[model samples]
Target: MIGIIDYGMGNLFSVSKALERIGVPYIISDSPEELNKTKGVILPGVGAFKDAMARLQEKELDQFIHQYVDSGRPLLGICLGMQLLFEESEENGRFQGLGLLKGRIVRIPDRDQNGERLKVPHMGWNKLHFHQEAPVLHDIQDGYVYFVHSYYADGIDEQALLASAEYGVQVPAVVGQGNVSGMQFHPEKSSATGMQLLTNFAKAMERSEELL
Candidate 1:
Protein backbone atom coordinates (compact mmCIF):
# COMPACT_ATOMS: atom_id res chain seq x y z
CA MET A 1 0.00 0.00 0.00
CA ILE A 2 1.02 3.60 -0.55
CA GLY A 3 0.46 6.41 1.91
CA ILE A 4 -0.87 9.69 0.51
CA ILE A 5 -0.04 12.48 2.91
CA ASP A 6 -3.13 14.62 3.54
CA TYR A 7 -1.87 17.78 5.18
CA GLY A 8 -5.01 19.80 4.35
CA MET A 9 -3.60 21.42 1.21
CA GLY A 10 -3.05 18.64 -1.31
CA ASN A 11 -5.33 17.70 -4.15
CA LEU A 12 -6.17 14.55 -2.25
CA PHE A 13 -9.28 13.58 -4.17
CA SER A 14 -7.67 13.72 -7.61
CA VAL A 15 -4.52 11.92 -6.48
CA SER A 16 -6.47 9.22 -4.65
CA LYS A 17 -8.72 8.72 -7.64
CA ALA A 18 -5.72 8.40 -9.90
CA LEU A 19 -4.19 5.76 -7.66
CA GLU A 20 -7.46 3.86 -7.58
CA ARG A 21 -7.72 3.97 -11.37
CA ILE A 22 -4.24 2.47 -11.57
CA GLY A 23 -5.33 -0.20 -9.03
CA VAL A 24 -2.72 0.96 -6.55
CA PRO A 25 -3.97 0.62 -2.97
CA TYR A 26 -3.39 3.73 -0.89
CA ILE A 27 -4.20 5.18 2.50
CA ILE A 28 -4.82 8.90 3.02
CA SER A 29 -3.81 10.29 6.36
CA ASP A 30 -1.82 12.92 8.25
CA SER A 31 -0.23 10.60 10.76
CA PRO A 32 3.33 9.56 10.07
CA GLU A 33 2.88 6.38 12.05
CA GLU A 34 0.11 5.32 9.69
CA LEU A 35 2.12 6.39 6.66
CA ASN A 36 5.24 4.54 7.81
CA LYS A 37 3.42 1.22 7.46
CA THR A 38 3.12 1.67 3.70
CA LYS A 39 5.80 0.66 1.21
CA GLY A 40 5.70 4.03 -0.53
CA VAL A 41 4.43 7.57 0.06
CA ILE A 42 3.11 10.35 -2.15
CA LEU A 43 2.91 14.01 -1.24
CA PRO A 44 0.43 15.92 -3.39
CA GLY A 45 -0.24 19.63 -3.08
CA VAL A 46 -1.87 22.56 -4.91
CA GLY A 47 -1.30 25.80 -3.09
CA ALA A 48 1.21 28.31 -1.82
CA PHE A 49 4.60 26.98 -0.72
CA LYS A 50 4.63 28.80 2.60
CA ASP A 51 1.17 27.67 3.56
CA ALA A 52 1.82 24.08 2.56
CA MET A 53 5.08 23.96 4.48
CA ALA A 54 3.37 25.39 7.55
CA ARG A 55 0.73 22.71 7.43
CA LEU A 56 3.30 19.93 7.04
CA GLN A 57 5.29 21.36 9.91
CA GLU A 58 2.20 21.64 12.07
CA LYS A 59 1.52 17.94 11.59
CA GLU A 60 5.21 17.18 12.18
CA LEU A 61 5.13 15.20 8.95
CA ASP A 62 8.09 17.28 7.81
CA GLN A 63 10.40 15.35 10.11
CA PHE A 64 8.54 12.14 9.38
CA ILE A 65 9.36 12.50 5.70
CA HIS A 66 13.05 12.75 6.52
CA GLN A 67 12.90 9.61 8.62
CA TYR A 68 10.93 7.77 5.95
CA VAL A 69 13.39 8.70 3.20
CA ASP A 70 16.31 7.74 5.42
CA SER A 71 14.84 4.23 5.59
CA GLY A 72 15.04 4.06 1.75
CA ARG A 73 11.29 4.13 1.12
CA PRO A 74 10.14 5.74 -2.10
CA LEU A 75 8.48 9.16 -1.76
CA LEU A 76 7.05 11.08 -4.71
CA GLY A 77 5.85 14.67 -4.68
CA ILE A 78 3.43 16.20 -7.16
CA CYS A 79 3.23 19.85 -8.31
CA LEU A 80 3.48 22.15 -5.33
CA GLY A 81 4.45 19.11 -3.32
CA MET A 82 7.41 18.84 -5.70
CA GLN A 83 8.59 22.30 -4.81
CA LEU A 84 8.57 21.45 -1.12
CA LEU A 85 11.17 18.75 -1.75
CA PHE A 86 13.76 21.38 -2.58
CA GLU A 87 15.89 23.50 -0.26
CA GLU A 88 13.74 26.67 -0.46
CA SER A 89 11.22 28.56 -2.57
CA GLU A 90 10.88 32.17 -3.64
CA GLU A 91 7.19 31.84 -4.29
CA ASN A 92 6.35 34.22 -1.44
CA GLY A 93 9.57 35.46 0.04
CA ARG A 94 12.28 32.97 1.00
CA PHE A 95 10.93 29.92 2.80
CA GLN A 96 12.69 26.72 3.71
CA GLY A 97 11.66 23.47 2.06
CA LEU A 98 12.13 19.82 3.02
CA GLY A 99 15.64 19.82 1.51
CA LEU A 100 15.34 16.21 0.34
CA LEU A 101 16.74 17.34 -3.03
CA LYS A 102 19.21 19.94 -4.19
CA GLY A 103 17.48 22.97 -5.68
CA ARG A 104 15.28 26.01 -5.08
CA ILE A 105 11.94 27.08 -6.45
CA VAL A 106 11.53 30.36 -8.37
CA ARG A 107 8.84 32.01 -10.42
CA ILE A 108 8.60 31.32 -14.11
CA PRO A 109 9.95 34.22 -16.10
CA ASP A 110 7.23 36.54 -17.34
CA ARG A 111 9.54 37.87 -20.04
CA ASP A 112 11.83 35.99 -22.41
CA GLN A 113 15.50 36.74 -23.08
CA ASN A 114 14.42 38.63 -26.19
CA GLY A 115 12.13 40.74 -23.95
CA GLU A 116 9.02 39.11 -25.30
CA ARG A 117 6.22 38.71 -22.74
CA LEU A 118 5.73 35.05 -21.86
CA LYS A 119 2.83 33.55 -20.01
CA VAL A 120 2.98 32.85 -16.33
CA PRO A 121 1.41 29.75 -14.72
CA HIS A 122 2.67 27.76 -17.74
CA MET A 123 -0.69 26.04 -18.00
CA GLY A 124 -1.15 23.41 -20.70
CA TRP A 125 0.49 20.34 -22.24
CA ASN A 126 4.25 20.28 -22.76
CA LYS A 127 6.61 17.67 -24.13
CA LEU A 128 8.95 15.90 -21.72
CA HIS A 129 12.59 15.37 -22.54
CA PHE A 130 14.29 12.58 -20.60
CA HIS A 131 17.78 13.19 -19.32
CA GLN A 132 18.39 9.99 -17.33
CA GLU A 133 16.70 6.72 -16.51
CA ALA A 134 14.55 6.27 -13.45
CA PRO A 135 12.47 3.32 -12.28
CA VAL A 136 9.26 5.36 -12.45
CA LEU A 137 10.09 6.33 -16.03
CA HIS A 138 10.61 2.75 -17.23
CA ASP A 139 8.87 1.98 -20.54
CA ILE A 140 7.90 5.64 -20.72
CA GLN A 141 8.99 7.63 -23.74
CA ASP A 142 9.28 11.32 -24.31
CA GLY A 143 5.69 12.55 -24.38
CA TYR A 144 3.51 15.46 -23.43
CA VAL A 145 2.26 15.90 -19.86
CA TYR A 146 -0.06 18.39 -18.22
CA PHE A 147 1.56 21.29 -16.39
CA VAL A 148 0.01 24.18 -14.38
CA HIS A 149 2.40 26.08 -12.22
CA SER A 150 3.74 29.61 -11.77
CA TYR A 151 7.08 28.59 -10.33
CA TYR A 152 9.71 26.07 -11.39
CA ALA A 153 12.64 24.29 -9.83
CA ASP A 154 16.05 25.92 -10.34
CA GLY A 155 19.69 25.41 -9.46
CA ILE A 156 19.09 21.66 -9.52
CA ASP A 157 22.02 19.28 -9.66
CA GLU A 158 22.42 17.58 -13.04
CA GLN A 159 22.51 14.11 -11.47
CA ALA A 160 19.04 14.47 -9.94
CA LEU A 161 17.38 15.80 -13.08
CA LEU A 162 15.42 12.99 -14.77
CA ALA A 163 13.30 14.98 -17.19
CA SER A 164 12.39 18.53 -18.17
CA ALA A 165 9.82 20.48 -20.19
CA GLU A 166 10.20 23.72 -22.11
CA TYR A 167 8.24 26.75 -21.04
CA GLY A 168 9.84 30.18 -21.02
CA VAL A 169 12.51 28.35 -19.07
CA GLN A 170 13.59 24.72 -19.03
CA VAL A 171 11.33 23.63 -16.22
CA PRO A 172 12.27 20.67 -14.11
CA ALA A 173 9.47 18.30 -14.99
CA VAL A 174 10.42 14.99 -13.39
CA VAL A 175 13.17 14.70 -10.78
CA GLY A 176 14.34 11.95 -8.48
CA GLN A 177 17.29 10.90 -6.38
CA GLY A 178 17.24 7.29 -5.20
CA ASN A 179 13.92 6.81 -3.30
CA VAL A 180 12.95 10.47 -3.45
CA SER A 181 11.24 11.82 -6.54
CA GLY A 182 8.90 14.58 -7.75
CA MET A 183 6.74 15.57 -10.73
CA GLN A 184 6.01 19.21 -11.60
CA PHE A 185 3.12 18.16 -13.83
CA HIS A 186 -0.08 16.54 -12.63
CA PRO A 187 0.19 12.98 -13.86
CA GLU A 188 -3.34 12.32 -12.72
CA LYS A 189 -4.55 14.73 -15.41
CA SER A 190 -2.01 14.15 -18.19
CA SER A 191 -4.03 11.51 -20.11
CA ALA A 192 -1.94 8.61 -21.50
CA THR A 193 1.33 10.16 -20.56
CA GLY A 194 0.08 10.89 -17.04
CA MET A 195 -1.48 7.49 -16.56
CA GLN A 196 1.69 5.81 -17.74
CA LEU A 197 3.66 7.69 -15.11
CA LEU A 198 1.27 6.68 -12.35
CA THR A 199 1.32 3.11 -13.58
CA ASN A 200 5.10 3.13 -13.72
CA PHE A 201 5.36 4.43 -10.18
CA ALA A 202 2.99 1.72 -8.93
CA LYS A 203 4.94 -0.94 -10.76
CA ALA A 204 8.19 0.34 -9.29
CA MET A 205 6.72 0.13 -5.80
CA GLU A 206 5.50 -3.38 -6.44
CA ARG A 207 8.93 -4.43 -7.68
CA SER A 208 10.50 -3.02 -4.56
CA GLU A 209 8.05 -4.99 -2.44
CA GLU A 210 8.84 -8.20 -4.26
CA LEU A 211 12.54 -7.76 -3.59
CA LEU A 212 11.86 -7.81 0.13
Candidate 2:
Protein backbone atom coordinates (compact mmCIF):
# COMPACT_ATOMS: atom_id res chain seq x y z
CA MET A 1 0.00 0.00 0.00
CA ILE A 2 1.05 3.59 -0.57
CA GLY A 3 0.43 6.44 1.84
CA ILE A 4 -0.57 9.84 0.51
CA ILE A 5 0.65 12.46 2.98
CA ASP A 6 -2.12 14.99 3.48
CA TYR A 7 -0.89 18.07 5.23
CA GLY A 8 -3.87 20.10 3.96
CA MET A 9 -2.18 21.42 0.81
CA GLY A 10 -2.15 18.71 -1.86
CA ASN A 11 -4.67 17.79 -4.54
CA LEU A 12 -5.68 14.76 -2.55
CA PHE A 13 -8.82 13.81 -4.47
CA SER A 14 -7.18 13.77 -7.87
CA VAL A 15 -4.07 11.94 -6.65
CA SER A 16 -6.05 9.37 -4.74
CA LYS A 17 -8.39 8.84 -7.70
CA ALA A 18 -5.43 8.37 -9.97
CA LEU A 19 -3.97 5.73 -7.69
CA GLU A 20 -7.34 4.01 -7.53
CA ARG A 21 -7.64 3.97 -11.31
CA ILE A 22 -4.23 2.36 -11.49
CA GLY A 23 -5.53 -0.30 -9.04
CA VAL A 24 -2.95 0.65 -6.45
CA PRO A 25 -4.04 0.62 -2.87
CA TYR A 26 -3.44 3.82 -0.95
CA ILE A 27 -4.36 5.52 2.29
CA ILE A 28 -4.53 9.23 2.88
CA SER A 29 -3.41 10.37 6.29
CA ASP A 30 -1.90 13.22 8.24
CA SER A 31 -0.74 10.94 11.01
CA PRO A 32 2.81 9.74 10.60
CA GLU A 33 1.91 6.51 12.32
CA GLU A 34 -0.66 5.71 9.65
CA LEU A 35 1.79 6.64 6.91
CA ASN A 36 4.36 4.31 8.41
CA LYS A 37 2.06 1.40 7.55
CA THR A 38 2.52 1.83 3.83
CA LYS A 39 5.38 0.56 1.72
CA GLY A 40 5.66 3.76 -0.30
CA VAL A 41 4.59 7.34 0.27
CA ILE A 42 3.52 10.16 -2.04
CA LEU A 43 3.66 13.83 -1.16
CA PRO A 44 1.27 15.80 -3.38
CA GLY A 45 0.71 19.52 -3.21
CA VAL A 46 -0.80 22.42 -5.14
CA GLY A 47 -0.13 25.74 -3.40
CA ALA A 48 2.46 28.24 -2.30
CA PHE A 49 5.87 26.87 -1.25
CA LYS A 50 5.99 28.77 2.01
CA ASP A 51 2.49 27.81 3.05
CA ALA A 52 2.98 24.18 2.16
CA MET A 53 6.28 23.96 4.03
CA ALA A 54 4.71 25.62 7.02
CA ARG A 55 1.90 23.08 7.08
CA LEU A 56 4.30 20.16 6.76
CA GLN A 57 6.40 21.46 9.58
CA GLU A 58 3.37 22.27 11.69
CA LYS A 59 2.24 18.67 11.51
CA GLU A 60 5.75 17.31 11.88
CA LEU A 61 5.29 15.62 8.52
CA ASP A 62 8.66 16.97 7.45
CA GLN A 63 10.51 15.00 10.08
CA PHE A 64 8.44 11.87 9.46
CA ILE A 65 9.22 12.09 5.76
CA HIS A 66 12.93 12.24 6.49
CA GLN A 67 12.72 9.16 8.65
CA TYR A 68 10.67 7.41 5.98
CA VAL A 69 13.24 8.12 3.28
CA ASP A 70 16.11 7.15 5.51
CA SER A 71 14.54 3.69 5.73
CA GLY A 72 15.19 3.30 1.98
CA ARG A 73 11.46 3.44 1.24
CA PRO A 74 10.33 5.07 -1.99
CA LEU A 75 8.86 8.57 -1.67
CA LEU A 76 7.41 10.52 -4.58
CA GLY A 77 6.70 14.25 -4.40
CA ILE A 78 4.38 15.83 -6.96
CA CYS A 79 4.32 19.42 -8.20
CA LEU A 80 4.67 21.78 -5.23
CA GLY A 81 5.65 18.75 -3.23
CA MET A 82 8.63 18.42 -5.56
CA GLN A 83 9.76 21.93 -4.79
CA LEU A 84 9.69 21.13 -1.10
CA LEU A 85 12.27 18.41 -1.67
CA PHE A 86 14.88 20.99 -2.53
CA GLU A 87 16.99 23.04 -0.13
CA GLU A 88 15.12 26.34 -0.35
CA SER A 89 12.77 28.35 -2.54
CA GLU A 90 12.48 31.97 -3.60
CA GLU A 91 8.76 31.96 -4.20
CA ASN A 92 7.80 34.36 -1.40
CA GLY A 93 11.11 35.31 0.11
CA ARG A 94 13.64 32.58 0.85
CA PHE A 95 12.23 29.62 2.77
CA GLN A 96 13.77 26.31 3.70
CA GLY A 97 12.54 23.12 2.04
CA LEU A 98 12.62 19.45 3.05
CA GLY A 99 16.26 19.21 1.91
CA LEU A 100 15.73 15.73 0.46
CA LEU A 101 17.51 16.79 -2.71
CA LYS A 102 20.36 19.24 -3.13
CA GLY A 103 19.03 22.30 -4.96
CA ARG A 104 16.82 25.36 -4.74
CA ILE A 105 13.57 26.40 -6.39
CA VAL A 106 13.56 29.64 -8.34
CA ARG A 107 10.94 31.46 -10.36
CA ILE A 108 10.93 30.78 -14.09
CA PRO A 109 12.29 33.70 -16.01
CA ASP A 110 9.66 35.95 -17.55
CA ARG A 111 11.54 36.38 -20.84
CA ASP A 112 12.90 34.02 -23.44
CA GLN A 113 16.29 34.14 -25.18
CA ASN A 114 14.76 36.54 -27.73
CA GLY A 115 13.68 38.83 -24.89
CA GLU A 116 10.05 37.95 -25.59
CA ARG A 117 8.00 37.93 -22.43
CA LEU A 118 6.89 34.42 -21.58
CA LYS A 119 3.83 33.60 -19.56
CA VAL A 120 4.21 32.68 -15.92
CA PRO A 121 2.72 29.42 -14.56
CA HIS A 122 3.89 27.55 -17.71
CA MET A 123 0.57 25.72 -17.98
CA GLY A 124 -0.02 23.03 -20.63
CA TRP A 125 1.58 19.95 -22.20
CA ASN A 126 5.32 19.76 -22.74
CA LYS A 127 7.61 17.07 -24.06
CA LEU A 128 9.88 15.29 -21.59
CA HIS A 129 13.53 14.58 -22.33
CA PHE A 130 15.16 11.80 -20.38
CA HIS A 131 18.39 12.63 -18.60
CA GLN A 132 19.03 9.18 -17.11
CA GLU A 133 17.42 5.83 -16.36
CA ALA A 134 15.17 5.22 -13.37
CA PRO A 135 12.74 2.46 -12.41
CA VAL A 136 9.88 4.96 -12.18
CA LEU A 137 10.51 5.83 -15.84
CA HIS A 138 10.33 2.22 -17.00
CA ASP A 139 8.75 1.79 -20.48
CA ILE A 140 8.54 5.55 -20.83
CA GLN A 141 11.10 6.66 -23.40
CA ASP A 142 10.26 10.31 -23.92
CA GLY A 143 6.88 11.96 -24.23
CA TYR A 144 4.76 14.90 -23.27
CA VAL A 145 3.49 15.53 -19.72
CA TYR A 146 1.24 18.18 -18.24
CA PHE A 147 2.98 21.04 -16.41
CA VAL A 148 1.51 23.96 -14.44
CA HIS A 149 4.07 25.76 -12.37
CA SER A 150 5.87 29.13 -12.43
CA TYR A 151 8.89 28.09 -10.42
CA TYR A 152 11.45 25.44 -11.39
CA ALA A 153 14.21 23.53 -9.67
CA ASP A 154 17.68 24.90 -10.39
CA GLY A 155 21.29 24.25 -9.40
CA ILE A 156 20.33 20.61 -9.06
CA ASP A 157 22.91 17.86 -8.96
CA GLU A 158 23.29 16.43 -12.44
CA GLN A 159 23.35 12.90 -11.06
CA ALA A 160 19.91 13.35 -9.44
CA LEU A 161 18.18 14.80 -12.50
CA LEU A 162 16.23 12.12 -14.37
CA ALA A 163 14.29 14.10 -16.97
CA SER A 164 13.44 17.61 -18.07
CA ALA A 165 11.10 19.56 -20.35
CA GLU A 166 11.72 22.68 -22.38
CA TYR A 167 9.52 25.77 -22.29
CA GLY A 168 11.80 28.55 -23.49
CA VAL A 169 13.85 27.25 -20.59
CA GLN A 170 14.77 23.81 -19.33
CA VAL A 171 12.33 22.71 -16.62
CA PRO A 172 13.19 19.92 -14.29
CA ALA A 173 10.25 17.64 -15.08
CA VAL A 174 11.25 14.39 -13.44
CA VAL A 175 13.78 14.01 -10.61
CA GLY A 176 14.86 11.24 -8.29
CA GLN A 177 17.77 10.13 -6.12
CA GLY A 178 17.66 6.52 -4.97
CA ASN A 179 14.35 5.98 -3.13
CA VAL A 180 13.11 9.53 -3.53
CA SER A 181 11.45 10.75 -6.75
CA GLY A 182 9.55 13.84 -7.88
CA MET A 183 7.38 14.92 -10.83
CA GLN A 184 6.84 18.55 -11.71
CA PHE A 185 3.97 17.66 -14.04
CA HIS A 186 0.67 16.20 -12.91
CA PRO A 187 1.04 12.58 -13.93
CA GLU A 188 -2.45 11.91 -12.61
CA LYS A 189 -3.77 14.25 -15.32
CA SER A 190 -1.27 13.60 -18.16
CA SER A 191 -3.48 11.03 -19.93
CA ALA A 192 -1.84 7.77 -20.99
CA THR A 193 1.66 9.03 -20.42
CA GLY A 194 0.78 10.08 -16.94
CA MET A 195 -0.97 6.86 -16.15
CA GLN A 196 2.01 4.92 -17.43
CA LEU A 197 4.36 6.86 -15.18
CA LEU A 198 2.16 6.22 -12.16
CA THR A 199 1.95 2.60 -13.11
CA ASN A 200 5.71 2.45 -13.32
CA PHE A 201 5.96 3.89 -9.82
CA ALA A 202 3.56 1.28 -8.50
CA LYS A 203 5.64 -1.41 -10.17
CA ALA A 204 8.74 -0.01 -8.55
CA MET A 205 7.03 -0.25 -5.18
CA GLU A 206 6.17 -3.86 -5.90
CA ARG A 207 9.76 -4.58 -6.81
CA SER A 208 10.98 -3.02 -3.61
CA GLU A 209 8.63 -5.17 -1.57
CA GLU A 210 9.73 -8.33 -3.38
CA LEU A 211 13.32 -7.64 -2.49
CA LEU A 212 12.40 -7.21 1.13
Candidate 3:
Protein backbone atom coordinates (compact mmCIF):
# COMPACT_ATOMS: atom_id res chain seq x y z
CA MET A 1 0.00 0.00 0.00
CA ILE A 2 1.58 3.25 -1.12
CA GLY A 3 0.48 6.46 0.57
CA ILE A 4 0.28 9.82 -1.16
CA ILE A 5 0.49 12.69 1.25
CA ASP A 6 -2.67 14.79 0.86
CA TYR A 7 -1.47 18.10 2.14
CA GLY A 8 -4.07 20.03 0.08
CA MET A 9 -1.31 21.38 -2.12
CA GLY A 10 -0.47 18.65 -4.61
CA ASN A 11 -1.86 17.77 -8.02
CA LEU A 12 -3.90 15.13 -6.21
CA PHE A 13 -6.29 13.91 -8.87
CA SER A 14 -3.69 13.58 -11.61
CA VAL A 15 -1.19 11.80 -9.38
CA SER A 16 -3.81 9.52 -7.86
CA LYS A 17 -5.21 8.70 -11.27
CA ALA A 18 -1.80 7.95 -12.69
CA LEU A 19 -1.00 5.57 -9.84
CA GLU A 20 -4.31 3.86 -10.43
CA ARG A 21 -3.61 3.62 -14.15
CA ILE A 22 -0.48 1.62 -13.28
CA GLY A 23 -2.71 -0.69 -11.20
CA VAL A 24 -0.89 0.23 -8.00
CA PRO A 25 -2.94 0.29 -4.81
CA TYR A 26 -2.56 3.64 -3.10
CA ILE A 27 -4.22 5.79 -0.48
CA ILE A 28 -4.24 9.57 -0.26
CA SER A 29 -4.33 10.85 3.28
CA ASP A 30 -3.06 13.60 5.57
CA SER A 31 -3.09 11.58 8.74
CA PRO A 32 0.27 10.70 10.24
CA GLU A 33 -1.02 7.34 11.48
CA GLU A 34 -1.69 6.14 7.94
CA LEU A 35 1.61 7.55 6.70
CA ASN A 36 3.61 5.67 9.34
CA LYS A 37 2.21 2.32 8.22
CA THR A 38 2.41 2.73 4.45
CA LYS A 39 5.02 0.77 2.52
CA GLY A 40 6.09 3.87 0.64
CA VAL A 41 5.21 7.53 0.84
CA ILE A 42 4.89 10.06 -1.97
CA LEU A 43 4.99 13.76 -1.27
CA PRO A 44 3.39 15.56 -4.24
CA GLY A 45 2.71 19.26 -4.36
CA VAL A 46 2.15 22.18 -6.76
CA GLY A 47 2.58 25.40 -4.86
CA ALA A 48 4.93 27.67 -2.98
CA PHE A 49 7.63 26.14 -0.78
CA LYS A 50 6.99 28.21 2.33
CA ASP A 51 3.24 27.64 2.24
CA ALA A 52 3.60 23.91 1.77
CA MET A 53 5.94 23.62 4.76
CA ALA A 54 3.54 25.61 6.90
CA ARG A 55 0.66 23.35 5.99
CA LEU A 56 2.71 20.21 6.57
CA GLN A 57 3.65 21.53 9.98
CA GLU A 58 0.08 22.51 10.75
CA LYS A 59 -1.05 19.02 9.88
CA GLU A 60 1.81 17.64 11.99
CA LEU A 61 3.00 15.40 9.18
CA ASP A 62 6.43 16.96 8.64
CA GLN A 63 8.16 14.94 11.37
CA PHE A 64 6.44 11.76 10.28
CA ILE A 65 7.65 12.28 6.71
CA HIS A 66 11.20 12.81 7.91
CA GLN A 67 11.03 9.69 10.06
CA TYR A 68 9.61 7.63 7.19
CA VAL A 69 12.37 8.63 4.80
CA ASP A 70 15.02 8.14 7.49
CA SER A 71 13.67 4.63 8.15
CA GLY A 72 15.10 3.60 4.77
CA ARG A 73 11.72 3.12 3.12
CA PRO A 74 11.40 4.61 -0.34
CA LEU A 75 10.01 8.15 -0.32
CA LEU A 76 9.49 10.14 -3.50
CA GLY A 77 8.88 13.88 -3.71
CA ILE A 78 7.31 15.46 -6.81
CA CYS A 79 7.46 19.10 -7.99
CA LEU A 80 7.12 21.41 -5.03
CA GLY A 81 7.40 18.33 -2.91
CA MET A 82 10.90 17.96 -4.30
CA GLN A 83 11.75 21.44 -3.14
CA LEU A 84 10.60 20.57 0.37
CA LEU A 85 13.17 17.77 0.47
CA PHE A 86 15.95 20.29 0.12
CA GLU A 87 17.55 22.46 2.82
CA GLU A 88 15.87 25.74 1.86
CA SER A 89 14.27 27.79 -0.94
CA GLU A 90 14.23 31.48 -1.89
CA GLU A 91 10.79 31.52 -3.48
CA ASN A 92 9.44 34.50 -1.54
CA GLY A 93 12.24 34.76 0.95
CA ARG A 94 14.76 32.45 2.60
CA PHE A 95 12.73 29.61 4.11
CA GLN A 96 13.82 26.28 5.57
CA GLY A 97 12.90 23.01 3.86
CA LEU A 98 12.65 19.45 5.17
CA GLY A 99 16.43 19.00 4.60
CA LEU A 100 16.00 15.47 3.25
CA LEU A 101 18.59 16.43 0.63
CA LYS A 102 21.49 18.82 1.14
CA GLY A 103 20.79 21.69 -1.26
CA ARG A 104 18.84 24.87 -1.92
CA ILE A 105 16.39 25.91 -4.65
CA VAL A 106 17.21 28.70 -7.11
CA ARG A 107 15.84 29.91 -10.44
CA ILE A 108 17.72 29.65 -13.69
CA PRO A 109 19.74 32.62 -14.84
CA ASP A 110 17.74 34.99 -17.03
CA ARG A 111 20.78 35.49 -19.21
CA ASP A 112 23.59 33.10 -20.13
CA GLN A 113 27.26 34.00 -20.63
CA ASN A 114 26.03 35.58 -23.90
CA GLY A 115 23.09 37.27 -22.14
CA GLU A 116 19.43 36.58 -23.11
CA ARG A 117 16.02 36.36 -21.40
CA LEU A 118 15.77 32.63 -20.84
CA LYS A 119 12.48 32.96 -18.96
CA VAL A 120 11.79 32.11 -15.30
CA PRO A 121 9.30 29.27 -14.91
CA HIS A 122 10.37 26.56 -17.31
CA MET A 123 7.07 25.14 -18.56
CA GLY A 124 7.29 22.29 -21.04
CA TRP A 125 8.52 18.72 -21.61
CA ASN A 126 12.17 17.71 -21.66
CA LYS A 127 14.33 14.58 -21.72
CA LEU A 128 16.16 13.18 -18.71
CA HIS A 129 19.81 12.25 -19.14
CA PHE A 130 20.74 9.74 -16.48
CA HIS A 131 23.85 10.52 -14.48
CA GLN A 132 24.31 6.80 -13.79
CA GLU A 133 22.21 3.68 -14.32
CA ALA A 134 19.75 3.33 -11.43
CA PRO A 135 16.44 1.59 -10.63
CA VAL A 136 14.42 4.77 -10.24
CA LEU A 137 14.75 5.26 -13.94
CA HIS A 138 15.02 1.52 -14.69
CA ASP A 139 12.99 0.27 -17.69
CA ILE A 140 12.76 3.93 -18.61
CA GLN A 141 14.94 5.48 -21.24
CA ASP A 142 15.72 9.14 -21.68
CA GLY A 143 12.38 10.76 -22.43
CA TYR A 144 10.42 13.93 -21.90
CA VAL A 145 8.82 14.74 -18.54
CA TYR A 146 6.51 17.68 -17.90
CA PHE A 147 8.10 20.46 -15.88
CA VAL A 148 6.72 23.80 -14.65
CA HIS A 149 8.74 25.48 -11.97
CA SER A 150 10.61 28.70 -11.37
CA TYR A 151 13.05 27.50 -8.74
CA TYR A 152 15.60 24.73 -9.35
CA ALA A 153 17.60 22.93 -6.70
CA ASP A 154 21.24 24.04 -6.57
CA GLY A 155 24.52 23.46 -4.68
CA ILE A 156 23.95 19.70 -4.78
CA ASP A 157 27.00 17.56 -5.42
CA GLU A 158 27.23 15.38 -8.51
CA GLN A 159 26.84 12.24 -6.36
CA ALA A 160 23.20 12.92 -5.46
CA LEU A 161 22.11 13.89 -8.96
CA LEU A 162 20.35 11.16 -10.98
CA ALA A 163 19.39 12.89 -14.23
CA SER A 164 19.50 16.22 -16.03
CA ALA A 165 17.16 17.89 -18.53
CA GLU A 166 17.77 20.60 -21.11
CA TYR A 167 15.89 23.94 -21.02
CA GLY A 168 18.36 26.34 -22.65
CA VAL A 169 20.40 25.11 -19.68
CA GLN A 170 20.81 21.71 -18.02
CA VAL A 171 18.46 21.36 -15.05
CA PRO A 172 18.52 18.48 -12.63
CA ALA A 173 15.26 16.76 -13.54
CA VAL A 174 15.57 13.60 -11.49
CA VAL A 175 17.48 13.32 -8.20
CA GLY A 176 18.19 10.50 -5.78
CA GLN A 177 20.36 9.89 -2.73
CA GLY A 178 19.84 6.56 -1.06
CA ASN A 179 16.16 5.81 -0.23
CA VAL A 180 15.07 9.35 -0.99
CA SER A 181 14.15 10.25 -4.57
CA GLY A 182 12.70 13.37 -6.22
CA MET A 183 11.55 14.61 -9.63
CA GLN A 184 11.29 18.22 -10.71
CA PHE A 185 8.85 17.17 -13.45
CA HIS A 186 5.35 15.89 -12.90
CA PRO A 187 5.34 12.28 -14.03
CA GLU A 188 1.57 12.17 -13.94
CA LYS A 189 1.41 14.78 -16.68
CA SER A 190 4.28 13.51 -18.84
CA SER A 191 2.03 11.07 -20.79
CA ALA A 192 3.36 7.60 -21.66
CA THR A 193 6.93 8.26 -20.64
CA GLY A 194 5.78 9.74 -17.37
CA MET A 195 3.54 6.77 -16.70
CA GLN A 196 6.41 4.35 -17.19
CA LEU A 197 8.58 6.34 -14.82
CA LEU A 198 5.85 6.21 -12.18
CA THR A 199 5.52 2.46 -12.69
CA ASN A 200 9.24 2.11 -12.12
CA PHE A 201 8.94 4.17 -8.97
CA ALA A 202 6.17 1.93 -7.67
CA LYS A 203 8.35 -1.11 -8.17
CA ALA A 204 11.23 0.63 -6.44
CA MET A 205 8.96 1.38 -3.53
CA GLU A 206 8.09 -2.30 -3.27
CA ARG A 207 11.72 -3.32 -2.92
CA SER A 208 12.72 -4.34 0.61
CA GLU A 209 15.77 -2.14 0.33
CA GLU A 210 17.22 -0.01 -2.45
CA LEU A 211 19.94 -1.63 -4.61
CA LEU A 212 21.68 1.68 -5.36
Best model number under lDDT:
2
Better of 2 and 3 by TM-score: 2
Q: After best superposition, candidate 2 residue 2: deviation in angstroms?
A: 0.6
For residues 1-212, what per-residue lDDT tens digits would candidate 3 score against the true structure? 78999999998999999999989989999999987778888999998999999999999889999888778888899999988999999988999999989899987777765676787788888778888777888777658888999888998868889998876667888888988889999999999888998888888877844442
* lDDT digits (tens) for residues 1-212 of candidate 1: 99999999988999999988888999999999999999999999999999999999999999999999888778899999999999999987999999999999999999977898988889999999999988888877758999999999999999999999988789999999988999999999998778889888887777777765
lDDT of 1: 0.92
lDDT (0 to 1) per candidate: 0.92, 0.93, 0.87
State the TM-score for model 1. Answer: 0.97
Residues 2-54 of candidate 2 have per-residue lDDT tens digits of: 99999999999999999999899999999999999999999999999999999
Clash pairs detected, candidate 1: none
Q: What are the clashing pairs of model 2?
A: none
RMSD of each: 1.1, 0.9, 1.8
| Residue 122 displacement (Å), model 1 | 0.7
Most TM-score-accurate candidate:
2
